[model samples]
Target: EIYYNDTEAKKYAGNSRIIEIQTAMSERAIELLNLPNHPCYILDIGCGSGLSGEVLSDQGHTWVGVDISASMLGVAVSREVEGDLFNHDMGQGLFFRAGTFDAAISISAVQWLCNQDQAHHNVQRRLRKFFQSLYKCLVRGGKAVIQFYPENGQQMEMISSAAMISGFSGGFVVDYPNSTKAKKYFLCLCAGSAEMNYTVPAAKGLDEK
Candidate 1:
């Protein structure tokens, strides 16, 4: 399922509705930043075809896109004329220096790291590393806005708990479950904070006992 080249990536990007949804999500996430200047450095993790970059550009924000897919990155490079773009993996940690960005956004990408059975622990570890990198890459009071599809309540808890443990505060979670599709989408925003210790309750249906 890896999009290995520009043409293959473009096929997926041609779906206007999905592109619109990704754009909407990115716009909503950027709205929460309340940044103070033009040319703000915004990072789009898992950027594909520059859909999010298009929205950010419309809002006058300077953006950088990163993704592991070469095809996807190539598509992004074509469409994201207004911003810098990179090919990188989120799981390996961001390459930028501390305080290099005003905000970061991830759209519908995190879930690809692992599957539902191993998601709880796998996602937590990945997110912890992500948050740590995010913390270093963003200025004080900067924000990371992430959106993904979680299998259930337990998955959501794993994500929130990881944020808290990673020294991020002001945590917020939003869930939209589509019953017909049997899927749940989650959006989380966490702010960097001094305190790093917090516990998340065991999710009610986690073990299915």
Candidate 2:
């Protein structure tokens, strides 16, 4: 379903305004990840067109990316992005070895998993499996910042509840609560101790039209 438009894929293959928006949204998630100064490996979940991976590469961090769309991954490969790219349905769970990534980030992707496209496609089960794999893939202190748009309160609860059941330090950060265009919702999860707390930076100037 994500591979709905060839023109959109082609546009991403080159360079365009959509990528700019993706990059910007992903940057916010990366900031929430809060990696150390030294280099670390990252997992870019739903890393469409490699735009978010570009940001990670620019930060001097190595990364691996996974997406459900072959067309999108094709575009990413054409860009010669500095990361390994592969195909995977996140609902089925990631295939990474335990503690393989320092951190993980997903931009505007998780919400898609909520769609019940198939009779066997259970949303809650899928969400839990996704988070379970994510928790295993991350290092002891690794955190995942997923930026998503919830259609309603039910989705938000279901998603958050799944994360908690999977054992993520349960909390979500809201960016630009006042803004329309720039508002973002990040579900923050930590694989390590529950005592590890962070102060999500304020939305700041993201609200400006």
lDDT digits (tens) for residues 1-209 of candidate 1: 45456666878878888787777777666665556676688888888777878888888888888887988877766664577778777766788998898888888887666553455566567777876787788877677777777767776666667666766665443423323332324344445555533221121122232
Give one digit per residue, the lDDT tens place, for model 2 in 38-143: 9999999998889999999999999999999888888888889999998899999999999999999999889888865754337778888999999999998788
Judging by TM-score against the true structure, name the best candidate: 2
Candidate 2 lDDT: 0.84
C-alpha RMSD between model 1 and the true structure? 6.3
Evaluate all candidate structures by whole-model CA lDDT and list the values in order. Answer: 0.68, 0.84
- TM-score versus the correct structure, for each prediction: 0.78, 0.90
Give the runs in model 2 whose Cα sits over 4 Å from its true position. 12-15, 119-121, 197-202, 205-209
Cα deviation of 130, candidate 1, in Å: 1.7
Question: Model 1, which residues run further than 4 Å from truth?
Answer: 1-7, 116-124, 175-186, 194-209
- In every candidate, how many clashes are there? 0, 0
